[model samples]
Target: MAKEKFKDAEKGNAVEKEAEDLENGNANADAAVPAPLYPKMAEDPRARWAFIRKVYTILASQFLFTSAVGAVGAFVHPIPKFFLSGGLTSIVVFVAILLSPFIAMFPMLIFRRKHPINLVLLAIFTACISCSVCILSSFFGVKAFLEAAILTCTVFIALTLFTFWAARGGNDFTFIFPFLFATIHVLLVYLIIQLFFPLDRIVYTVYSLLATLLFSGFIIFHTESLIKRHGYDEYIIAAIDLYLAGVNLFTSLLGLAGIA
Candidate 1:
């Protein structure tokens, strides 16, 4: 009887051990299995490529638009002068000049989101500026026009190159912005004062020189932003706005330098 009882207890112990081993095996197996990685949770590989293509297209459009504006300005240069008198000329130029920043930004206003319209607007703006200069020069006298153009172009180019050098050559130009703005505002106030007086012929010249410097900074600043943050979607309008600013600045500088 004793032997039989011992045998029964051993049997029970063996069964329990076997059951535990089975449970352990199951637990190990469950732990070994990996969860499925859902494709939908991640960004598609093709999305990046599509964005890159769109950006390239936007940039291409900007180049094309800028060329078109330049052509238009050149074509318009030979037309007979439209208006005269320093007051009338100044008013037209002022309106156009003041309107420029707004015009350049028009695309941004329309898109309700950032897009390439800014680029294209910038290009158109540049063309308008060149045309304005050409027209002013046509009436102002050929010699004066040429002289102004030369001056404007030279100053514009210099500013661009200098800014580029600073950007690439290791100077952080972002810090200079406040100084530039302050200087510009002071000059603008002076211009307003001169406008009221009309007695100082020299004021316009000083204003022109100041404007040349300011616009040069603008070109660099705009172009830098274009390269950095504006992105592919903003190219078209950005280009137009920049182009306008450039041409307008150049022409205005030319006009100021040329006009008596």
Candidate 2:
């Protein structure tokens, strides 16, 4: 419980830092802002590919690392093959994965690092903790589990693409805060219920779709805020928040897809 609160605090800090950037307008970070995070658009074809490359690199690394974690957990987990079928096992696995963003975000915020290798160990453990839930759930059926895992990965990919798209173009998806907040509030309540009750499959499906949409908007919104609009010259923290958003979105999608 304390861990969750800490994680939430971390997420809040990310937003606060971005707001600071917007208010202070520190010209020092101008170079790091890149094109999408830039206050104004500049014609840079390389910027598009650059963002693309970074995103794809993260996506690939995240999945491979996450899968490895799941595999390790499956071996040492001492849990039953029917763990995700229902009962306490499902609840345990479900809640752990669902709250993973909060878990990872809390620590990542306190000390941000630029180089991926600097935090590779932490990222691996975090991925294992979260992905273990998905892997255990998959034990119910390989095909079902794969679909869920793949769907989760797909949402993260979508978010990365959306961020890049928002950067390249002028669509400005930053205006969806009200709806996003409301949706997240509702989703949280709904998820709490699902932890104890049997939610309708249709509801899960709708929530899944909404999760993808919400997180995609978040990527575009946060990326723009941190660079061009918001003031997270502390790119390390900003990256952590964005990564959390992506990972949580993937987790949500996996839940829905697994049932589908």
Candidate 3:
């Protein structure tokens, strides 16, 4: 009887020890799991607002830099001519345009954890785009440039407000992605056609109008994505997306104004 009792006690102790070990293992597993670096911003109002603010601030700064560079390029007589004359400026602009996507991706790929490096790459990309803008604006003259800038800003602001309202109404813009992808390819084909066969004035005007509208849609979609779809850590990507939309809008407006 004592031998049986001793064996039962040993079994009980072993089971208790096994349960204790399982609990510890569970605790260790829980502790080992790391927190997410990119949290959903929609869950936190303060965080969302802060992220929006940072994104817009960066966007505004980029706009100002582009404008300043464009103005300098336009007024400085030799600069525009140099770029337009198929010379150094043209080569630089071409190279920049060709390499911009890679340059922009560089920070995201390698230096994402380093803010200074990301900022530098962003600035360089912005500068390259600004140089191209400067060359294009030079053809339009200052008055047209100013008009296009004003119109672009007005349209952008209106679309941004609409995006905010749509977000408040819990609208999802994910459905537009397929349409946008198709439209972009169509636009690219149209541009390639323009390169080979010069489009008539009416066709050019139509193209510009359509381009402006498309970019306006993009602005809304990107803004909505920034607010609702993107994580809090995606500020750089958000800024770049918005900046491209704005720049494209301005260029389309410039073309529509018959200045390009």
Candidate 4:
């Protein structure tokens, strides 16, 4: 009887020791992974409001520059003529303008967090991309360009206001990102195939509409992300996110207007 009692005591001690080790292990694991602090930053009203103001200010400046460049490209008679002219000089200029955005993007991304340099790089990137956009706009002429610009602005404002209201109501739009990402990849593949075989007019129209909606979803997602997910120091990235979505939406709208 004593032998059995001793054995039982040993088993109890072993189990207790194992449970203690398990608790320690869990504590270590938790310590190893530091908790994210963005929630704290995002929760502060002053910080959140400041971040929003900075991001929107930068975005507004970019759009102003883009609008100025677009007007010059569309309404300036000589500018359109020069770009449209089928000559060696025109071809060279067109190719350079097309390639400029890619060239600027690399440095802009690299210096995205480097303060004054980052701002300079952002300006260069904005200029290059805006130039490319305006060049494309020139091809559609003044009336279509103006209409698309107005529509893009109106849609952007409505979406911005809606996103703010939705976010304030505790709506999370980040879940749609995976679906949007997958669909955009599929659309990209379809567009590449179109280079070899031209799509039917109806098909192209459908594609354009799909792209416009996709970008609209992106704007909403990114805007909500700005409100809830982005860190305090991520203002530049936030601006870029909104700007890219707006530009893509504008291009898609421009395509529709051109076709119409």
Candidate 5:
């Protein structure tokens, strides 16, 4: 009985020692592994990919609708004439066009997560933006619009590809956002000053070049944010970010070409 009791005590010690070893091993292993840079990204891969697909799909739809409206405004003489004709109706339409985005945007933000309502708001926002694009394109004529469209598409594709490659290589671009914000505000102030002062053509050219570069940076920044900072559930916000960047790029390109 004494021998048996001693043997049992030895067995218990061995088992306890094994468990302690396992616990230390696990701790060491965990310590060796790096923490995820984006915790939300560590969710299911399928969900993340699906989110990207949805965002791009929505963005494509937005571009298509804007392009269509732009075509109508540019090619259809009656529409542009009606809008550009100096009258109370034209003035009202012009003001409405300028204000439409803000009107739709606020409601969209409020209902961004509310399913079909959010979708409705998104459509309204897209239509508003489309109207603005259409009006701008109408001023530029078909040839200039087409040229700007081609250039914008090229720039957008290149930037998107570069963004993906840089992301894969572990580059981060979120840091540039503050600089971008400051620069945009400065540009807006400059734009307001330009409106009052009527700067030279060379100055306008420089301004357009700077704006193009700025919006290009926005494309890179926003695209990377989509891959890194945004979660799967923020597809609406992501789509809007990319769409705005695209629209701004086109407008800047138009200005760069001296067509706007």
Candidate 6:
């Protein structure tokens, strides 16, 4: 009986040690894994769709507001005349162009925390951009403006659909970043050159064509980034990116149509 009791005690001690080892192994495994960086939108369809809806809603609103401002800027005699009078030679228009980007960025930086201040800043930025667009549109006339608007809409819709299809097929656009960066730099150089040596109509047309293609690609990239990479909380930034893409695409098309 004494020998049997001693054997049982030894068995109990071994089982306890094995159990402790298993727990320690689990703890180590848990420690080895890191937390996720963004919300798991991929796993939650509803959350993903909600985020997408918010982004597009804001984008549409901005577009409509811009369009209204553009229309006003185009029709009002004084506004159009004032903007086009001196062309690039006009000090007021030149100053506005130089300052517009900084003005737009200021609001984006200051009111980034989601407040009424952001809305106010967004309005100001949109107004500035709309004024610029109006100036460009006035040079093109009503017919060119309408044609460009139609083309822009068609292209935007098509690209958006393609982006969704590609994403569903498990394709990410990570490979295009380097090419986009290079192309954009080349375009910037061309733009700077044009500033010094005004390009002829044919060259301007070619530049506009290239710019349209580039911004179309940008739309795809920005949309995919919004859907796959950005967190749900980044709706504001995503909206801004998409809005810029749309605006650039429209302007490029307008130039290609020989209106700007």
Best by lDDT: 4
Residues 109-181 of candidate 3 have per-residue lDDT tens digits of: 4654468777787888787788778877887777778888899889999999887877776667778878887
Q: lDDT by residue for model 5 over 1-260, one digit each (tens)?
A: 99999999999999999999999999998786644334344655555666778989999999999988988877877777877788999989998999999988998988888888887889999999999988888877787788889999999999999988777777788888898899899889989999889878888888888889889999999898887778766788899999999999898888766434
Q: Any idea how many clashes model 4 has?
A: 0
Q: After superposition, how far is residue 135 of candidate 4 from its true place, in Å?
A: 0.9
Candidate achieving higher lDDT, 1 or 6: 6
Give residue 253's error in model 4 in angstroms. Answer: 0.7
> Least accurate stretch of 10 residues (summed lDDT) in model 6?
34-43
Q: What TM-score, computed on C-alpha atoms, does each candidate reach? A: 0.52, 0.59, 0.76, 0.81, 0.82, 0.78
Cα TM-score of candidate 4: 0.81
Clashing pairs for model 2 are: 18-231, 21-231, 37-228, 225-230
Model 1 scores a TM of: 0.52
**In model 1, what is the error at residue 153, expressed in angstroms?**
3.4
Collision pairs in model 3: none
How far off is residue 70 in model 1, in Å?
Answer: 9.4
Model 2 agreement with the true structure over 84-151: per-residue lDDT tens digits: 46888678866776577566665665555546543664474457455655455444344544665676
lDDT of 4 by residue, 1-260 (tens): 99999999999999999999999999998786544323343265656777888999999999999988987777877877887789999999899988998898888888888899988989998999899888888888788788889999999999989988776666678889999999899889989999999899899889989999999999999988887878877877899999989988888888899899
Displacement of residue 114 (Cα, Å) in model 6 is 3.0
Stretches of model 1 off by over 4 angstroms after superposition: 1-82, 85-108, 112-131, 237-241
Candidate that would win on TM-score: 5
- In model 5, where do residues sit more than 4 Å from their true spots? 1-41
User: What shift in Å separates residue 118 of candidate 2 from its native position after superposition?
Assistant: 6.6
Using lDDT as the measure, what is the rank order of every candidate, best first?
4, 5, 3, 6, 2, 1
Off by over 4 Å in 3: 1-42, 86-110
- Better structure of 2 and 3 per lDDT: 3
Task: Indicate whether candidate 4 or candidate 6 has the larger lDDT.
Answer: 4
